[model samples]
Target: MKTFARLVDDSANFSSDITYKKGGSILSMIETVLGKSVFQSALQSYIRTYQFSNADHEMLFEKFTEAAAGTVKDWCERPMNVTRFLDPWFLQQASALKK
Candidate 1:
């Protein structure tokens, strides 16, 4: 899929497809890039900080990037923004996962 629906209409019927699976794959990529412990900590921090508060995608991007920078090993350093890093996998077709 070129893009995913952020919110599905309640009146619309749900379809099971690879696009639905993509979200989990993206999280898996994050866990692979950052260690599982680091990813978990970051996810928890995001939830705790934004609980009962409306949080946008930028907030999530910032939290994950901050956590990765602090925890990821020196060799895996990334110079790009976390949102940019993730956008390709999210916006492009499913083939991106092969990388």
Candidate 2:
């Protein structure tokens, strides 16, 4: 499976700053909850569940979400009527959707 292992340290902060926009602000979300290993398990779950079936990115994500919903169902839900995503569906659509 392909892996995006790019990492940055303090000394490379300048480069990180310049390059971060390319990664869609995910660095902040990930770094905020850095030690949450249970959430990280989604990677292994994705690799196991959809590695062979879905070859495209969209299909891959759909399969990954399905797997995560099975394994970590609670994290997969976004606030619709519930207080999940901080924003509603329209706002979520307006906000950066790449992540």
Candidate 3:
């Protein structure tokens, strides 16, 4: 989420750098923990469900958990600390979990 700008903090020509984004790693983790098919379907459903509506993180998680049924049932059903689960990848500027 680094910004592309000159020395000045208030530079008008500022821009964002998406090169170092973590969306790919996040997707890979979700796919690996769940399954490619489930992940894809979940994402598709999420898109369709929220096409014209605003969605929160909880809604996305619920969709994924629902869609992950039978594919990664155990993992999806197991309880985990949501904050700990999401904070690393989302809060950190440059971080990606291998597991």
TM-scores of all candidate predictions against the true structure: 0.66, 0.32, 0.57
Q: What tens-digit string does per-residue lDDT give for candidate 1 at 22-42?
A: 778888987887778878878
Per-candidate Cα RMSD to the true structure, in Å, reads 9.3, 13.3, 7.3
Candidate 3 residue-wise lDDT, 36-92, digit = tens:
787788889989999999998767777777786554644356643333455577665
Whole-structure CA lDDT of model 3: 0.66
Q: What is the lDDT for 70 in model 2? A: 31
lDDT per prediction? Answer: 0.73, 0.42, 0.66
Task: Please give the lDDT score at residue 13 for candidate 3.
Answer: 35
Point out the higher-scoring one by lDDT: 2 or 3: 3
Candidate 2, residues 1-99: lDDT per residue as tens digits?
Answer: 899978755663546644546444543443233224533554566577677774544443343344344334334354111123322322342344545
Error in Å for residue 14 of model 3:
10
Best by lDDT: 1
How displaced is residue 20 in candidate 3, in Å? 5.2
